[model samples]
Target: MFYLTVDILGTISFAISGVLVAMDKKLDVFGVFIIAFVTAVGGGTLRDILIGNTPVGWMQDPIYVFVIFGAVIFGILFRKRLKYFRKSLFLFDTIGIGLYTMVGVEKGLSAGLLPIMCIALGTMTASFGGVIRDILCNEIPVIFRKEIYATACILGGASYFLLRKLPIEDIYAYIGAILIVIGIRLFAVVFKVSLPNIYKVEQ
Candidate 1:
């Protein structure tokens, strides 16, 4: 049930995200579809392969494919209403990160992975697809330099595990994780919060 919700949200967010980027590039219908597919499935595909989940998650669950297509169509049709592209990206990315991170942690826990690996798993689940999408698009990924992106996912995953160890139920833990990710992201964006640039340091 929880996984179902995350799948829907993650696919929708990624599809919209990909479409918005496509629109920026003036991509045609086929181009939009390809971008949406990569953004929506890349991360989950990587995570599944790393975890040795045969057939991969999206391959086994056909609904996710349909959902991505539907989301892309909806994004195209409503592209005008989604006038504020940057705002939409921020909002959906925040949500997508939260949902993806939570489910990744859950999957890791189910697989009996340690908490540290779960943190890595959660980050991969939330951000790697965007990484791949950007790479394919011949650009740097936004999260690589922008706001408190991937770190928010990682921190929220760690926080979720910590909270779960307490008396909280699984649902509450999920909610807490989502909220923390969202809060951190929004706060970072609004306040211009950013991580240190290790590479740009003086030689």
Candidate 2:
């Protein structure tokens, strides 16, 4: 139940993120759909692969595909609503990170991975979709540029790992961990928190 909640939240958020970027890029309908697809599935795909789960997630659950496409149709019909979409997109994106991070960690533990590896999976599951979407769209991935994007997922996953050791119930623990992640991301956005540029050192 906890996992499902987080998964759906992330899915919707990332889907909106894709739509916004597509609109900004002036992509055609097909391009929008492609971006939507990539953003929605990219993280989960990486998570599944790292855990050695053959055939991956969406293949087992066609509903995931439907959900993403459903969002695409929504975006297409309501493209003018882009202004209104921004807040929802951010909310969903933050919530999704929390949810996906928790789910990723659980999957990792179930797969018998090390704690560090699970954290990596959690972060990947939360942020990789946006990465792929941005890359395909010829823009910077949100996770790479800072704004506490992947860091939120990282902290959320780690928090889950730590909180699970407490006396709290699993559901409460999970939600708590997710809240920690979402809260951080939202806080970062509200505060305009961002990492310093490292490109200056590239030369």
Candidate 3:
């Protein structure tokens, strides 16, 4: 039940993020839906394929598609309001990635993967959708840039692993992981924290 809720919320959040990006790019209705759908499911699809899960996740459950459609409609209807709350949209995207990181870690554990692999999977699941969306929008992938994006996912996955070793219940551990990812992202954004760029050429 927890997993399902997180998955649904994450999908909706990513879908809305995609809608905002599409609108910013002045994409058509079909293009908006396409970007929304891909942004919502691309990460999970890649994760499932890497884990050898046949049919992928969104394909197995049509609810994901419906959620994306609903999110697109909401974005279209409330675009003006959304424009005033771009930061809120970013918050939603952050929460989506946090929840997605947890889901990915759990799925990786179920797949008998190692801790490091699980963390990698979690990061990929949390960030790959945005990568796909950016590519489609002709922008650089945010995850690849000097931002605390994938690093947050990695930290969240690591925190989940550490918390599982404690005496607390698994639910608490999951919540902690989610909070860590979201909090890190929020803190980074608020403080303008970013990874140092190492590839600067002489101007």
Local distance difference test values of all predictions, in order: 0.84, 0.83, 0.90
Which candidate, 2 or 3, has the higher lDDT? 3
Q: Give the range where candidate 1 is weakest over 10 consecutive residues by summed lDDT.
A: 83-92
Runs in model 3 lying further than 4 Å from the true structure: 1-3, 200-203
Q: Write candidate 1's Cα lDDT for 101-152 as tens digits.
A: 8878878888899999988888899888888888877888977876688999
Best by lDDT: 3
Model 3 scores worst on lDDT over the 10 consecutive residues at 194-203
| RMSD for each of the candidates | 2.3, 2.1, 1.9
Candidate 2 global CA lDDT score: 0.83
Better of 1 and 2 by lDDT: 1
| Model 3 local distance difference test score | 0.90
Which candidate order results from sorting by lDDT in descending order?
Answer: 3, 1, 2
Model 2 TM-score is 0.91
Error of 2 at 69 (Å): 1.4
| lDDT by residue (tens digit), candidate 3, 75-190 | 89988898686776677778889989988898899999999999999999999998999999999997787789999999999999899999999999999999999999999988
